[model samples]
Target: MRTVGNDLVRSQLHENRKWYLGLGALLVVFGIVLLAALPFATLTVIYIFGALMMLGGIIHFIAAFKIFEGGYRWFWALFGVLYLIAGYYAFSTPVKTAIVLTNILAIILIIAGVIRIFNALLFRAFQGWGWTLFSGILTLVTGVIILMSPDAPFWVLGLFLAVDILFQGVNYLTLASYIRREVPKSSAEQ
Candidate 1:
């Protein structure tokens, strides 16, 4: 028998199934587009990134003034200003922005990979820790390769991003399905 709390959780998941499915469909569409435009992905990605940055900059700028209190309020404003400038520059020179963003992505991946490896090491007490370590190593290697040749095969980045997005979408859909299946059962039991 399931508890009331379990029924609530299941019901919530069931109610939100449509949202998950919608998100999954959206991501799958994006992945299809990326695959279809594999050849033009390099230039296309530049513009996409530029647009995203500009949009993010606008959001950041708006957020800057919303801080009611804090010593770092101005600091956020300064960063916001920088974001605006960078966004404008990106929109103006998308190719340049692409290269820079790729390099930045590489560096970030490297850092994240190192952190993951360390975390995996600390998780030695847990089972299947080796898988985490292996993934970390793979991530680290990929970062290093990207850092070495950020400009080479730029389209691959788009392809990979698309694939990653699609996978995330599928995961959401699967979770939603599981919730839908289990929720009704739990409620019925209750």
Candidate 2:
């Protein structure tokens, strides 16, 4: 499948720039708060994750019975059960869950980074490919560090999370500004 680019997202969003600014500001504020109260925030994050996992498990459990056919149904049901147990354990012991989550995050980041770098190389002729390559290198390094030192301080994990939020906020704000500047042009083109 083709990846949806900025043009697609830009077309889908409303022309109202205010919403973007508001959301970006909210995310930045939350990031700041999380950074300031890292320990509590980390715990809070774990709790939220636990809840989501539980919800996913419940949904999967239902799907197993409702949608799957014959033998495949058992697999989904088993998967759902696993999710439920993991979610329950996460809720019961958030600290331990956070540690596990950190390792999982590291693995995911590494994979994502490799993908980004490969794509950046493939599209090196395009503008901003260098940025993608740079970002991917940073991501890969962060993941490698995390993987190597899985027992790093909770604060480090918290800092990473905060940085992610801050970057996301900045990106949103930038996109919002760009949209604001191009609103008239976009409207005209439409």
lDDT of 1 by residue, 1-190 (tens): 4577777777677767899999988888877887787646666776666677667776766776775357566676777777777768877876676677777778778888898899899999999888888888888888888888745446556766778877988888888877766556555545
Model 2, span 1-190: residue lDDT tens: 1224544555656455677788788889989988997777777778877898899899989999999989889999998998899889989988888888888888988999999999999999999999999999999998899888845436556776787898788878987888767643333246
Steric clashes per prediction: 0, 0
Which clashing pairs does model 2 show?
A: none
Cα lDDT for residue 136, candidate 2? 97
Model 2 — which ten-residue stretch has the worst lDDT? 1-10
Q: Model 1: which ten-residue window has the lowest total lDDT?
A: 181-190
Q: What's the TM-score of every candidate structure? A: 0.63, 0.66
**Top candidate (lDDT):** 2
lDDT, residue 83, candidate 2: 88
Candidates' RMSD to native = 4.9, 7.3
Model 2, runs deviating above 4 Å: 1-15, 107-141, 147-153, 185-190
lDDT at 78, model 1? 73
